[model samples]
Target chain A: MLARDDQPTPPLKRTPLHALHVARGGKMVPFAGYDMPVQFATGVLKEHLHTRAAAGLFDVSHMGQIVLRPKSGTLADAAGALERLVPQDILALAPHRQRYAQFTNDQGGILDDLMVSNFADHLFLVVNAACKAEDEAHLRAALSDTCEIEVLADRALLALQGPQAEAVLSRFCAEAASLRFMDSKPLPVMGLDCFVSRSGYTGEDGFEISVPASAAEQLATALLDQAEVLPIGLGARDSLRLEAGLCLYGHDIDTSTTPVEASLAWSIQKSRRHGGARPGGFAGAEVILDQLDHGAPRSRVGLKPEGRAPVREGAQLYAEADAADPIGQVSSGGFGPSVGGPVAMGYLPAAIAARGGVVFAEVRGQRLPMKIGSPTFVSPSYQR
Target chain B: MTTLFTPDHEWIRVEGDIATIGVTDYAQSQLGDVVFVELPKIGRQLKKAEAAAVVESVKAASDVYAPITGEVLEVNETLQTDPAQVNTDAGGAAWFFKLKIADKAELEGLMDEAAYAAHTA
Candidate 1:
């Protein structure tokens, strides 16, 4: 749920360059808690294709950024407390590294998926824009009395993504490209101080820069001047991430899905497994450990719909001949600009998923042939 | 040829008993980039303002309503391969189908250009 909004939305969020977007005639819509552009005057296909070729700038400022501090010094203290709830091994992370993980419930279902960065001074975290409040409340409830969580409201996040992304961003933070995938550093981009993380949702190479909200527009405009940059909207952002095989919280990975069933076992620390030093004590650890030992009943899989027709989210999937007995349903689906066809990711029987065969997605009334493929429809181009 | 529009944003061109049906530019724009179009089979019977076809955009899935009751005599097969025709030339080549008017009186209920402008407003 969003904070109370008593007034009508202003078409779209103004960003710092609401003027530029309006000048360019962007198509805006309400997303998360902000009015964001779904496409520019050109359209979605063009914006998507542009990101594949040049670079696309995304305003992800609505995403929440939080700083965690241990009352004392060691991050291990914080990680130990966090491990009781989240699936990632925070303590195992070396300094300046980040990991993609989720907060799981007692039933092993994911409450939210987020990025956690182990900083030299603080444990930095970023969560989805829509669930910021709920995530914070959950974190506070789980935090030990000694740990303190602070919201970074003054910061704004931007993602510059594509093949030429590094070349353009290099001009701002030359050393940024040198940082390996999932590594972050405090860097100055166009004289704007920010945390430059070698990360992005798009499978393409990119960076998510967190800067003071005050300097966001200046930095965005500066990047757009590079000729290769175009202001991307939430529409392309969504399609790009879907093509990358990344899960969108609420849509793909929700409170009903667990790290194990979502095929995110890698995020679980080895220590939490039955063989590790800590057998199973985390919340829902019993169920998670049982799934680990005996395998989950269902697992997330990538579904490639035949032809250009998309089998979108919530569309039912059934056995090839039998229409009534549904085996699974689509969680996320769309037209992948790179693949030049329709693609979807959904959950199905783990046994069916293990073999990697064909299935049928019931789009409308016709059954479309679907091949089970790897999650990333295109090869991920992260600058590792 | 009078351009008549249904409340659902479908527009029909009437010339005698044959009425041509297609979604309006406004409706297409709201649906975002057109990706797929589910064209109804020929000879399908349609009621006045009934769903005659499906227009699937990248952002959403919507049904094209019949502006005037009739029997669907022909559907635009071109939409199967190039749905963007609707976004690019909605009133021209993107016409969804042609219907044999069951009763000409149904066309009177649809809005004219001036009335459509007000209805959309």
Candidate 2:
């Protein structure tokens, strides 16, 4: 159970931009052991729409940042070592390119999803904040023999995302505009050295800059000083990523979900697929590959509620006419300001995962009608 | 007519036996970006401190509690088309419903304007 306001609160960690958030009218909340801003004065609705229209500056420093290097100081084959833990083709990942991957357990269930960027010499990794400790331990157990899992505690991460993102970031680093989607480059941003990646959680053309913790505030202030940029909080970040059809670590995916069932087969490259050259060497590859060949029992699908009431997380889903046995449940649901409707994502039986299929979400003892659709409520505008 | 508030942040403006109920401005500000509201049905009995209504914001869903025992008389229909009314004018036109106050003694127990202001403070 979470501690109440008057309760002797556990010490919450603060990010480098914590003070900046408070100065900008951020509503601070305890999130994943960090005192993070859930929203600012603009609120979630406006902040989300603003990010889609212009650019939004997000302080994502709560996410764990780590670098994997050979203990001998020479660049080890970090990708090869990492491939044993995840079912992605890390070895094929070109230098300066980033790939989305997941750490699967023996049963093919996801432990955590992460971003792996090949930095030419070492691998730069980003994992979810809540899962960082376990992820770090897992990495150490899996790859510590070959590479040192160095947690970069001194760096802060910032994401500048939207259509106008390039225009805003170009003021500091002109070379950032040249990077393609999922490309990374080490450059000087506003006099601060940073490793900037042309990617973000929001499915928009943007950049994620990793800066030294001491210089993070200056970089954030400079970016927010731009006309097109506004400081977005975690609330808008959740809604934006939800509308983009991305899975939140603990909510949409967890230890019980596999890549195939989570609708992330695209992340498993062809080289790792069954009958391919590499076939499968990663954890839970047998179950994952089998699910890939023969479909999984359930599939993740998007739901558009019939009425205005949002079908929130944990709301059970049943067939429109039947209420005895629920067919699925809403893993994530909220108002999609851009779509101008209530959008939700959830897992459903493969037979009923048909597009435009009708279902009912049992919310507060009421059966609310909903229609199943593709996971993406809004089409992604990535620069790729 | 006098305005009374519940500890849970709902406000009731009472005129004789009829009372208008809505979440306070502080509550709206805390909720942020009201998107959808599920109003109580007319004639539905609401016990004090019960979940009388559901307000869905951009972030999550919140329950608006009843300050006194009453039967729902009228619901603000404007919220069906535009729920942001709560965020725009929370204590005024965005009132959720009208209730026939069940007991005058229950109203006496609620916090007055000065008490509410300090309670929220």
Best by the DockQ measure: 2
Query: For candidate 2 chain A, which ten residues in a row score worst on lDDT?
Result: A1-10
What TM-score should be assigned to candidate 2?
Answer: 0.97
Give each prediction's DockQ, rounded to 2 decimals: 0.40, 0.52
Models, CA RMSD each:
3.3, 2.0
TM-score of each: 0.93, 0.97
The alpha-carbon deviation from the true structure for residue A272 of candidate 2, after best TM-score superposition, in angstroms, is 0.6
- What digit string (tens of lDDT, one per residue) describes model 2 on residues A1-384? 011267677899999999999999999999999999999988899999999999999999999999998665555367778889999998888889999999999999999999999888889999999999999999999999889789999999999999999989989998988899999867889878899999999878899999999999999999999989999999999989989999999999998999999999989999999877788899999999999999989988888998988888999999875669998899999999898879899999888895457999998888999899887988888887
Looking at model 1, give its docking quality level.
acceptable
For each candidate, give the interface RMSD after superposing the true interface residues on Cα.
7.4, 4.6
**Candidate achieving the largest TM-score:** 2
- How many angstroms is residue A305 displaced in model 2 relative to the true structure, after the best TM-score fit? 0.8
